[model samples]
Target chain A: MTSSIHPTVRLTSQQRLEGIWNKRTYTIVRLIGEGARGSIYLARIGNRYVALKISQDSSVISAEVNVLKEFKKVQGPPLGPLLLDVDDAYISHDLKLAFYVMEYIDGVPVSDWVKREGLSWLFPISFQLLKKLHKIHQLGYIYGDLKPDNILIDRKTKQARLVDVGGVTALGRAIREYTTWFDRGYWRLGDRRADVTYDLFAFAVCLLSLDPHVTIHNTKERDIYKVLNQAKSLKPLTPILKKALSGQYNNALELKSELGVINRKQLQPTKSNRKTATNPKIDFWPEALGLSSIILVHAGLFYFLFYRI
Target chain B: MHTGTIRQILLITDGCSNQGEDPIKVSSMIAQKGIAVNVIGVLDDDQTEEPVGLSEVNDIANSGNGISRIVYADVLSETVQTVTRQAMTQTIQGFVSKELSQIFGQETNEEDLPPETRGEVQKVVEDLGETVNLQVLILVDTSASMQHKMEAVKDAIDDFILSLQARTGDHYYSIYQFPARNQVVKELLPWTNDGKRVNKVFPKLAAGGITPTGAALKQTVKAFQNVPSSEEWRDDSDDIIDSSYGSSY
Candidate 1:
């Protein structure tokens, strides 16, 4: 029986991988990210480094590879890591693992970026992420697992990019992967069906999760709403998020437009309101107004990205 | 892509079968009818030694032509969804592999295909996986050893059904537990799409009985055939479960 095979592939430090199918060789650098389905390793294919995902289940490798392929067909900005290679390798005499290599984006996850840069970045980051989600949703797929780990912020350009398409399910199909915190079913708010709204719902949760104060317990609907409402950093966008969480927006486009309106509305008040900002009673308002100038630039970028698609 | 529906019997248990018939044999018979019998061997977190039923779980899956997983109770819901999706893709790959054999005039597995062709085949398989009608018969081992694990089992089933709503394919789910008070198997909830029906039945689930896995599996095969109640199981199936429970939310 194959029961004794380890759930994950553990290799010696700087292990070398020679593919059986493609006759390609790669040297491992280190483990990058580990998911429920597989562990991703940063590896050197030749002189260049690529992200390699190895799994015991060949179908998982195949499904994700296909998603990356689908990403290439989308007409806009790159959706995820580029698919480079797909092959199988022998870990032991009896154990063969299916692996696919992709172009590695050297960036921090969005959560880390938000923590480092502060709450103002949330608007621009969400704008970029919603654009990507809208593109994929147009192809009748939902980014089923839309947590922060799956979205990476480029170190130099500070642009948001999506990674890990393992949970990309067809819009109507059962969601194959999800995190408990981002899942609407776990919150007892909505069903787990893959749809445009499902990703939007998760997008709302993903945004909420950036706030260090917001933690969702596995019980009570009113308590979750209370916690989300009380978050100071997320207060301005709370109404938009609430609409998304309640499945008010029909598609990512509708959600994107609503978000665009908020950014614009946030921008209008900044110029006139800057003079009276030093008052102790309105300290929070000044900080919120400060984010508007950044939101204006991002709002323009959002339009460029929107029509170029 | 295979156009017909995919049928699966997901058997979840923590220990070995103690009475009635050989589960491996029953699984093989079920496999012969083109229904895969996937098994998940649930284990408690602190347990050290391997459970007695671990090998039996592998044997059943092997003979039944399905995937088998042994996971801790904490991750049961995730494993349940993964195994189900894996089984669907595996089944489709199997058919695609056979068709490839005819075209190439040699035995060729889908994985053995060149990477480009494999990607195309995988896309087809994934598309088919979404659209193909799926019917899963969930078999839970409700022996005394599994008493503490019932909460995890209940959550897993609920999660599984809720997850299925994302699929475009029509799904029919039914729950069957082994070793009812008198009989080998009892129907907790008949085939239904509403996951809420499971909430009603878990309250009635009392875990104190022998593990008649083989007999339970035999009854599962009969249930898949749409046989209402065979003579021996008819009397006990009526006592606790109301017929209305299957169809109602």
Candidate 2:
């Protein structure tokens, strides 16, 4: 209930979230945003800064935590760098809440930066976004929601990274939710999700926000009007994009493709789109080729200093 | 180091995986010498279209996931002298994708919530309001570990996107990626299930860069926006999103 208490920082009660970490520290972070299915935080652990989140309940949180643990086990060093040091311990809070900590982000959202810089955030970072999501999906968990904010783009490196991952919908949850409504589909014991299709839809919404086209609408309906007009607008894919764009057939796949539906493939343009991949005609995310992995390494070092500020 | 060869490799290609762009064949072929069978599928057109890999001796025919069809790749290896030879065959499981999931596996329906439960759900939801539609930001490591997993992730996300389309509410999604270099924001697809021209746009992706997760996160957050709506949304636009240093591993 608005976190019965206020976060130590004057960050305002965006919904104060304070919970226990190791019995000695009861974390207090200002609520930042409502993530996938719960609350997010910009917390202060003693003198250090972190982002925290508490999912709906212990069961759901456990599933996500378990997935996170699996992730901690399998991911490469460059993928979602394991942030939180998860623990199951009794806390200062009355209710036993599931909490995890992550490095605190210090920059403004790309949206604000776009508005501030007054430049199009599209075409540069958008395509690369899909590639990242595809990798996450490969890791065997659905991001459930893929949006700009969930993605943090470093100004120095100009690359994107994913965060706020506590909400992972497993196959069990999907089966539990759909047993009655749909009389079809086989149910697996610990499957991913029966309806991961929704991630694509969210992918579309995320893309539209970055695409300069949807913003031009300037109406309450926003992109809805353009979505309804998909019958006429979406011309055939442009040559190289043809490989990524053309998908499915007459059934729902064709329909999804035709409507410019945002799927994982459609979002991540390949090296051909890069400058010197020999396919110069297709200028996908050119900035990607010129940059180096060193930037993230530096960002890691820089952020360590930035967080201190 | 333990080295094993794959007797047969199966790929599900919905056009995500390149026909001959793979480097896993050596490992697989080596595994073949040990009489190991590996199945890979490259999903073609829809989950049903024929894939080229299905004909590579041990490959199975083209069949997409989510359709309830299964493709089987069986490998048989015979060691002759010091060398080993393998024979591979692919089979398709003829079953409606949904029906294959077995019976009564749907999620439990949310019956009229008991008053207390309803009240609690409503309170949390009300607290969330417009922000209920959270966003997902993706970070992909195009490193050596990223090769085979790339296409699989793309396919899984494609299915996930299709699944989220059924619900209502204003949800928005954006994509950005990094390897050694930074890729641009290729496409911004909005969340509208009207179907026609839905912007199912996946870019032509390949991996080359080192994993730059932190930089990628900053690049993505730079595109984040606070949609103006009358919901209990927390406004940090005034303060804003930051380039937080973090990674999944």
Candidate 3:
């Protein structure tokens, strides 16, 4: 695995640009997103552009790097960012920092994109994105911190890139949360992301959140309530990710082989809105109305004849 | 009225700031030059009635960085800054007492636990030993400060569950950790006998939720409902006592 760049409490300005400045590791030309956790920078290596993430804690950095490494080792599924390079090394006695490079498509965060170009444009890409997350689980590392901020969207291509593995745990400490199976040693379904199925659930939540009609801004009461409810209800991955999502389906390769990266007929919403049947029973309606109208006409004819006579 | 020169009177409360006494002003005035007084603004739910008005004081109390919010209880709605600060002083005294006990472990026959409390704890342990229904409902505080604390609790609970299970030699005991949030709003997983499964669920319990002790208790009681209760178990004070007001964690 490529060494990832890590953050530290101590580091000279020059040393901070070790692999970042020079062509040896990366060529960080511009800064990207910044949040409470860390910062992301857009950099270049050879002709390809990449995203670089710099975090504070070493464990966070390790968790992220390990996830990417694990994903790559398992030849991860095709949903999120592909790990390219890393800067996993200590700069000094006091400073423990690390970071890594992702396939940085020149894109903005999906939420920002939603704010910019209304919700109508969210589909296929959003669907593809959720489908990709399922692939991530298949690859076997929980996107421990699954949120809009972590997942970046390529504005031009409308593709989603999954990033940030910091909060993830392969074999980690007790975060003591109560779940159905509370015994020790046995992997609690809540604690670890053993399979891709759970990630699919999260992906579903992500998709529903991105829905144009819905307003899922933060982790507020409404947001959590709606999203978690919607997530638990999602039926299956779109036909694209269906093969891989199925029970008999084994290996991430089968998905790519079955369906290419992009669908030719993109899922864009049109004005001819398909009225999804919400258990509408229209069979008796037309006949009942027509019969009523016929009876009324006949009665009117009979009344007219009787009045004339 | 020489109640011994008060070094620093800390007011750790949820509603003190709301009660016309500005926590920031008070804490700042005390912390500036001479005295080392502190004032804390607890961010508790208003439904509890105790945390009202105090949420507003967070900015001011944390302003000078002199006064810190020491301990804020979940689920109660009363402004408890006064009570909390008083408890804090008591806590300090308790700590000093503990230190003294440690130093004079052999010499001092210290009275730490009240006779009644000791008897209750003894009864709980003894009751636990009797039937081996070792139900360890681990209510972990998943707030930011309690991350390390959670780690400790997980370890302790793990060890405790292991020891208890070893004694009983059955899949009986369980654990349920609650992130500091009220159930009226949202709750994490409820209680279960899945201590073995905690290893996976632990990381999912990240910090950053409001403390809701009532909800936690309600959830805990719900967890207990799954465990088979007996007349022997019902006769104990734990069974007789109501849990709604008791959950301070």
Top model number, TM-score: 1
In candidate 1, list every pair of residues with a backbone clash. Answer: A172-B166, A173-B166, A173-B167, A174-B166, A174-B167
Q: All candidates' TM-scores?
A: 0.80, 0.36, 0.39
| Candidate 2: fraction of native contacts reproduced | 0.00
Model 1's DockQ score: 0.37
Top of the candidates by lDDT: 1
Sorted by lDDT (best first), the order is 1, 3, 2
Q: Looking at model 1 chain A, which ten-residue stretch has the lowest summed lDDT?
A: A276-285
| Candidate 1 residue lDDT tens string, B164-216 | 87677778889988878878888998888887798998987888768888888
Candidate 2 structure quality by residue, lDDT tens digits, B77-99: 00100010001100111111122
Q: What DockQ does each candidate score versus the true complex, computed on alpha carbons?
A: 0.37, 0.01, 0.02
Per-residue C-alpha lDDT of model 3 across residues A1-309, encoded as one tens digit per residue: 011111222333224334422224555666666643356777666777777777653223434555565666544344456777655434454443456678776668876765555443344345555565555555444454455666776665556666555434222221111111111112211222233433433443455555443454443342233333433212222443333222234433444344333433333432322232122132223334567889999999999999999
CAPRI quality level assigned to candidate 1 from its DockQ score: acceptable
| Order of models, best DockQ first | 1, 3, 2
User: What's the TM for model 3?
Assistant: 0.39
Q: Judge candidate 1 at residue A104 and give its lDDT.
A: 85
CA lDDT, every model vs. true structure: 0.77, 0.35, 0.40
Each model's chain A TM-score = 0.82, 0.54, 0.52
Winner by lDDT between candidate 3 and candidate 2: 3
